[model samples]
Target: MRIFDPHIHMTSRTTDDYAAMAAHGVRALVEPAFWLGQPRTSVGSFVDYFDSLVGWEPFRASQFGIRHHCTIALNPKEANDPRCREVLDILPRYLAKDGVVAVGEVGYDSMTPEEDDVFAAQLELAERFELPVLVHTPHRDKAKGTTRTLEVVRESGLDPSMVVVDHLNELTVGEVADSGCWRGFSIYPDTKMDPDRMVAILTEYGTERVLVNSAADWGKSDPLRTYATGQAMLAAGFSADDVDQVLWRNPVAFYGQSGRLELEGADADEGATFEGNSILRGARAS
Candidate 1:
């Protein structure tokens, strides 16, 4: 089951996770900009993080033969911080770069007034850049968060087809489905949707505009959940074509709207370096 994980956080993962994901048939992924486990104190902190997303992380993923792409945004969780607000200003520079497939992880976190303002600003940036968006619904009060999310998307006047409302469940998927936007589910190990539940969702929704991801981050998340979901689909009698649609084709179709997705197989040149640095630890002996 070839896979393209539409959302994940490799910044917080290890190289072992990359090797495991590649072995499990994960060929490509998109790592959205999101809050670190702790608060980021300055705009410079975000600058470093975003640079790694566009630079170091892709190099790391390539070592394991996984094509890595990313989204650029001031995530909603940090929108309330006056210090981090400057991140929005610097986003345009990153948005113009290669490997930035969308403007993402942008939506309500606390649903605060500050979040509303930042979310709207990023959505406008998406319009200006003509890029796809990855909207992250609130983990708390998700149904209400998703409702307001779709409303904001409508108000932005960006084509709903260019937006993906992520972290949805059975309760919220239907509304996004009807909104003409793509639907995204993050399959987790213990919380949120799991493989079986995702299978059931696919069974009902028919896999047309669905994007399944692990969304694995610096928490108790599993990086291999995308692969697990594909296995579950097969166990539940989904055809190889059906699994491919959800795991590969759907993500390519959604993020492909950016006209920037580089789906080429990962070719790791061990001698290749980013900024005069390599993932290698010691010199090789002949």
Candidate 2:
């Protein structure tokens, strides 16, 4: 089953994870810009981080035969900080860079007024850039957050088709589905929707613009959940084409709006060295 993980944090993941993803049929992914576990102190730090997302992460994923793309944004959690607000100014420059397929992970973290301001600005950025958005709904009070999120998106006047409201669950999926925006579910080991639950959603929703992702990051998340979700769907008697629509086609249709989604995911040359240093187990250092 070919997979395209539409939301994940490869910045916090390792090459071994990339290798495993490729081996398990993950052909492409989008790593949305997000807050680090700790606070970022300055705009320059986000600059450096965005550089790595479009630079180093893509290179690393290529070594393992997976296509890598990313979204650029200030991220919601840090938008409340006065210091990191300067990141909003620098986002356009990175958004123009190749492999930045969307402007994302850019919705309510705490639902502060400040977060609201930044989220609105980034929605405009998505409009200006003609890119799809990956919105992060607040984990707490998610139902309320989701309602407000739909309001914000509707007010932005960006086509709802170009926005993907992510991290949804049974409680919130109905509203997101009804909103004309794409629906996203994060399959996690715990604390989020699991594969079985995802299958249940498919059984209920019937998969039009629904998407599933692992959303694996530095936390205790599994990078293979997208693959596992596909597996569970098959076990639940969903056909291969149905699985294809949810796990692969939906993401392609969403991110493909960028007109920059060059899907050479399985076409990477297999080499295991970076910066003239060998990464292979027994290669002589040259």
**Local accuracy by lDDT, each model:** 0.89, 0.87
- Per-residue lDDT of candidate 2, residues 100-202 (tens digit): 9999889997899999999999999999988889999999989999999999999999999999999999999999888899999999999789999999999
Candidate 2 colliding pairs:
none
Clashes of each: 0, 0
lDDT of candidate 1 over 157-204, digit per residue (tens): 999999999999999999999999999999998999999999999999
lDDT at residue 88 of model 1 (Cα atoms)? 90
**Backbone clash tally for model 2?**
0
